[model samples]
Target: MRPSDRVTLEDVARAAGVSRATASRVVRGDTGVTAKKTKAVQAAVASLGYIPNSAARALVSRRTGTVAVVIPEPDQMIFSDPFLTQTVQEISRDLDEADIQLVMVFGDQSGHGRRAAKYLRNGSVDGAIVISHHRFSGQVEAIMSVQIPVVFIGRPVAQASPNSWVDLDNVSAGRLAAERLLECGARRPAIITGSLDMVAAHDRLRGFREVLGRVGIDPVLLEGAFTAESGRAAGEALAPRIESGEIDGVFASSDLMALAALEAWRDRGLRVPDDVRLVSCDNGPEAAAANPPLTSVDNPTDILGRAATDMLRAILDETWDGQPVLVPARLLVRQSC
Candidate 1:
């Protein structure tokens, strides 16, 4: 047949000597058709070059077969952050298997919550999966008000009541990081935390502090954005204290910051794990590939993404009862600590 000649299900049904309904069932892999008839329909479909109209089928099914993934950050940041990249890839894979389309929406950090709210209210997609909820500005309320299913990647700070979220056990991750450093016999451990306004960072810090306090060690705390630049600045700021022998160990809340601290230590000609033991969060590839490697906390981002997608799917399917899912974190030991 010519490339311009389009094939339809009806043509396949005629060639297979079966009703169009039976041909469709065969094509869709629906059960109940006899094996012989199914094989005949399949052969006819192959010979006729029959291609199902997915869009038309969706229209008839009242399902767009699409899910919206909302990221509250600039495109550049999204691409730079390994955690976000892993989460997105996992979510996309899960959605692909379910035959659902993933529509990505990038929102401005400043006033992103309101913008996200407005975007969802417009009803452009079936449901939404929200990431980076720290920048959320009443967006949760807006999302909940939309009467559409929404699942959050991390714990939302603004909302006092726990909403449906898929997150790592950041508090336990923090405790583990501190414990690992202490087990190495490093004293006077200090922590450089991500934005405390976010619950993940806060919980991690709280956990670290609790463990350190139990051991009678009070850690010096500093706050920084989750970026290499901020990590560098944090390193410089903490240099004097390290030199004065007041700080012997350090824990960075993110891998980016940990890398910066490692560089800062190198620049000052200080021996890692000897002079200042360091541990970081997020065991991304970069963390494992860093010079001397980094002792880091490993959060299952792929699993978290899958869980988030499942939660959103449940809500959309009206099978969820609004429960938060918490995934665990593991500690990976390496040369840095």
Candidate 2:
């Protein structure tokens, strides 16, 4: 092959003294090809430096072998949020095992949503898995219009309804967190929630409120943007009340925020659990590492990722009838609550 030129499958087939079909079968690991012929094709493929064109293979197979994972969070938040990172990690690992390529797209900021729409419309991928669709831009509308297979990571907003999705039992997670605190003899509980626009946050809060209300405790609620900064700010704002002994227990929607709340309490010279108990969601690494380890709701991101990939594969195979998959969440109790 020329130094600057790309090698083609035809060259490999010719070098191997085999038909292109035989070479393709060997490359795809199909059983029909004889072992001797497979060895010859692989040797030729190596000698000619023949790299299969994924796009071309996709065209012939009617499979892109590419899945796009869209996160509608800003670039900074996408990197900082443990849940998003862990979920994507699991998705990538699962897709890698299936020899599928994973494409990551960030739709958190303003113009990126439009870019995501254009990319999906271009038909460069077989399907998409959407996460964190709190913002209601034209992006969700664009994704829905593409007429391709889509599996959402969480329950998408109303605009993207009638679409298949995989999500943890967020309501149960919330109730579990609340119950943990209440079982510990917590009377005055405060909540720091994610943006109310997001379904996960809404469901989590709803579950928590239901449990607390049944027990005759009016929970104090605060809204945070699912960031450590927002959590810290909420904590600082609530410190006065906390100091006054008005709030005895606290639950932040996410572990990242919950950790910040822990620090905020420390800054106010208050001890964890001893002075004020705390709990949060997304039982990620940070929760375990937090001082006076944080009790949290486990969302099982890895399981969710694998399930979403399976759903997309089913859709690709025409086996899915557009059904939603619900994964249950569990509670991880620690010293913080």
Candidate 3:
């Protein structure tokens, strides 16, 4: 029998009828394994649902007096995204308290993960904090090669992602947004989701779907790249549907997206809460500053950032008990809905 979230490499090896070393070689992308054994290992992994543990990859106890904060995004995004900046700031503030230096690494577009991986493999830092990892970016493989104490700001979209992380209850946040829309007596509701490559975005979408499904409202789903440009694009796309009365309410994935939707609707001469209603996630200053004031789900970034740092520090100190922290998100209702 296979265990969930605790499947070990050794178990996979035994199930595959190969030596543990051989299984390790395959998992690490070693090309030395024979074709017959490689097929067996693949079948075993799929049947048993084996999840690779990053913490077990040649974990070495070392102190480098520094920690790396890796953001897998371009410089322009680093400068514009308040969420990313706040995450780094909270981590930096916490690290400064313990006299640890923070080295910011930008793992940007195409092949940047490899460069980031190369720097990390040099054993230059005691630990690392990874944020905004995407699917197929190869960032997961890159970070796993380091063997340092690493923590993720959000769970990566990979089966081999490290288990340790502190994050908001995004499902609850999505449900809060959907509930707010329904409470306002909206007849036709829709959702604008963030990039599905991130686990938080998927969780938020799932929660929204679950809540709306229970009430017989099949929401119109729109995807966004978690950027202002994408948000504006989504808003423009929704304008036509709003005019046809096909979408009378919206659950935007972020405050920025919600504000963009407000602008789009206003430009179309539609009044919020009268012609359409809007609720958003990531309650921030912009939400409060909107013309009608947006109702939003608050995923406290400060709590998540500090909690992740605290978990990383505990891992560094050998005092961690291996429990994950899940901070609940709350809705801040305003006039927009």
Scanning candidate 3 in windows of ten residues, the lowest lDDT window is 54-63
Summing lDDT over every window of 10 consecutive residues in candidate 2, give the lowest-scoring window: 134-143
lDDT of each: 0.85, 0.87, 0.83
User: RMSD in angstroms, candidate 3?
Assistant: 16.1
Query: What lDDT tens digits, residue by residue, belong to model 1 across residues 248-296?
Result: 8999999989898889878998778778889999999999999879999
Per-model TM values vs. the true structure: 0.86, 0.84, 0.79
- The stretch of ten residues in a row with the least summed lDDT in candidate 1 is 135-144
**What C-alpha RMSD separates each model from the true structure?**
3.0, 3.9, 16.1
- What is the Å distance of residue 225 in model 1 from its true position? 1.3
Q: Candidate 3 lDDT, tens digit per residue, 125-222?
A: 88888888777566687777777778888766565666787788899988888888888888688888888887778999999988889989899989
Per-residue CA lDDT of model 2 for 37-144, tens digit only, reads: 999999998888888887787778877778899988888999998899999999999999998899997764566367776787787888999988874656566667
* Per-residue error (Å), model 2, residue 55: 5.2
Clashing pairs in 1: none
